[model samples]
Target: MTDSLHDIPAVVNREGGALDGPNSLVDARVPAPIAPSGFDLLIDVRAVSVNPVDVKIRASANGNGTDRILGWDASGVVLAAGGDTHLFRPGDEVYYAGSLDRSGSYASQQLVDERIVGRKPRTLSHAEAAALPLTGITAWESLFDKLQLTGGSNGALLVIGAAGGVGSILIQLVKALTDVTVIATASRAESRAWVEQLGADIVLDHTNPDLARQILEVAPGGVDYAFTSQSRGRMALFTQVVRPFGQIVAIDDGRDLDFSALKDKSISWHWELMFTRPRYGWNLEAQHELLNSIADMVDAGRIRSTLTRVLSPLDATRLREAHAIIETGRAIGKVVVAAER
Candidate 1:
């Protein structure tokens, strides 16, 4: 039997095109269907969402001598399953944030581990479902697994970068599942209004030099929880508004930290990397379970997909435009590419 991965059309960040700019993400074809091995599922991907990881990978692309697909979040139907796969069978509609080590989801067909995938939300289109996986997983883990927070936390929570994909979903998740007062930072008026509509109790300006003072004024005692990307150069201010014994979680890359500032208040620092489970083979099933729970939330109207923009045809040009929109640092929510039928 022919495998689904073979003979499928895909968008590739061309190898050795590191200098070619965003145009390097061209349409291409895989030479052969990659047979699924243990625990893998062969999927005919229907939709995919872009993130900063895709941009970073494309920018650093050195010729691997083959086209490198670069997308992580996708929704698709299983065309085949590995012999060891038990979570899903052929024809299952599923969604996931694919592992960082694997070829990504920007293809007509993809091979992903069954453990890391979940049944797609019945209430959502593939595009809508695709927008949730990466951001949903990150927000879920940041709140429950990393911050160990629940609906009863009732204290104030601060979210920096609250207009981006992760932040959009994070605010909704916190509002839906917790009683915490959300203070989100959005520098622009439109972004601030968007966050307000998303249920943030207060929206602060991120660019204000005395932003910490502002947050302190709003929360008074300090925020009990915060989630931010890139903690560098602003840890002192963050520490100022975070109460003693409060928690701060981050998802950015390596940066030097001055633990001494947070040390005085006994603040807990958490790092959320949604890829950690599958990257190191730890608790892969948790991702599957997490997405399932999110789907339930979506179906019940307790939450909504954060897909603010949807591009069509899924061509390289569309992808380039999507990447540009995201890079502008002004997008209020996720940008997804819906594959044409």
Candidate 2:
């Protein structure tokens, strides 16, 4: 079915700027997407979560003047499915971190590939489930794909910025799936408590200049794996605290990282971006499988949604508010916005 004129509600960023700018993020009505084909599923978006990517993109240069719809994590119901889609039906509830190449989930409706989508956790609300996909996929990939961790693996893992979305979920995934000891860093008391509650075995203040000494006190020799959500100025720290031949994985876009610092210890550095799969079509179904696993874990009570805040009636204003919160780099857990009132 075709949409009525300007029927789909969306929040678009035009000429990216600071949150206070006139066009940073604004309410608009766009035409609904066409019928699903191939592996596509047309979704009636129920809830979406704000991530660091959204904030970064919103502040980027918009030289082309395209109105960008910036969102990744979403929980929704399938409204229709393409002929080749075998995983879901019209009424199935699902969640996914959609491709960065397409219009994202900050809208009333969206079209996503079934390969990157999964059944939503039955026990969680849409707002809660909305907080999982992007961060969940990232954490899963970082542990299994990048760090090459398995269920029987036993080692100490140091998580930097452990109170944010990915780190919060990462800690839980590690604790549930492996026997690793988690040493997480959080600069604030509430953030420290949040990570600890999520299963961190040890917590350290990220602001402390003597962090390496504290980590060494716990791990003795050094940590076996280090995951940093923000890796801008911490490469040297990882080089010092990660054991010889240990692994370091990061999700940041810091280009000034010095790889030379890691050579003396034979340390390996890896980068994880959840969009890499959908963006490259590299084993896209892996995300579908991993997300399903995460959902099962959530349903079994081994995992919990990290959703900590909810903003209602998804609109440009609320989206801008969410972006501002993320930009501060101090948000604990996840923040979601419900598409409907």
Candidate 3:
């Protein structure tokens, strides 16, 4: 902490409870953020993007009963670096999905590990840059790391909830890096078009009761991989539609799922949580490297930002509205709130 939290205003979840009420999140102040002694950088936060995790965290704050800042993805300029910091300097433009253990990017400034931060994509504004980190990391790890895809797999992929932020980027990455055929699930007309534009080879109405049959009609035997961006009851259906030895990956915290259904078919199930690296200090620099590569791809036009909505000068009111939009499960991509310069 830099200055006392009581000294500066910020949006916060002072009392974790249901977001249905106005008091669920409110205008509050947090201690001015400060970089620790080493391995961290202090940033002047300029923009932030919301994720479903924000809503969950707000609704389940630590039982200690103290308020906490709520943001994970942000783009900003570095203002200070710890004594041991080597990757960045004051005035550097950066973006990152911050660690789960620290103060977040919902304030005027924040502290972030330099190892997990990346140079902002040259072609994007702070608002656009903020939208990429969390989802970018999640999508990258979920596809390549968990699925172990090294390109030219010639496999077919089925993306459940394919119009969301992670799915949007995953589709682009699959299209850009491999010959894999992509079948994306999108229920709405606009979302269907969105995934198609992002390079999904086929689009199916995930709302259909016979979604597996629909995918099989187009994919022949079954898809070689399944990325379940959103599913619960549908896991069984996925097991039925995936080819033997197929891979199933997910970014969500799926509960009540039994892996036994995939036993005979030899399916491999993997879970991806982008926060794992930063939280445990495990290969933390991977985020920095991956973000840079993604930025390069963005500059080269092989990939694009998934930002779909923007609000200005982040505040509790605007944040609450963003939360509502996310909870409704209708947001097509990332929703951002940028501070006016």
- Point to the candidate with the largest TM-score: 2
Residue-wise C-alpha lDDT for candidate 3, range 1-341, written one tens digit per residue: 24563456678777777786656777776666644569889898999999999989988855876778889999999999999999999999999999889878888888898999999999999999999999999988988888878776787999999999899899999899878899999999999999999999999998998887898898888999999867688768977899999999987877888889889899989988999998888999999999998999998989999999999868888888888889899889899998863
Candidate RMSDs in Å, in order, are 2.6, 1.8, 1.9
Q: What tens-digit string does per-residue lDDT give for candidate 2 at 84-197?
A: 999999999999999989999998899999999999999999999999999999999999999999989998999999999999999999999999999999999899889989
Worst 10 residues of 1 by lDDT: 14-23
Higher-ranked by lDDT: 1 or 2: 2
Once fitted onto the true fold, the runs of candidate 2 whose alpha carbons sit more than 4 angstroms away are 1-6
lDDT of each: 0.87, 0.93, 0.88
* Candidate 2's TM-score: 0.97
Q: lDDT by residue for model 1 over 1-341, one digit each (tens)?
A: 23354466778876533424644688777754478989999998898999888877787746555668889999999999999999999888999999889888888888899998999999999999999999999999999999988868789989989988899999999999989899999989889988998899998898899898899999899999989975778798777999999999998774678877899899999899999999899989999999999999999998889988889988787888887787676888899998963
TM per candidate: 0.94, 0.97, 0.96
Looking at model 2, residue 60 earns an lDDT score of 92
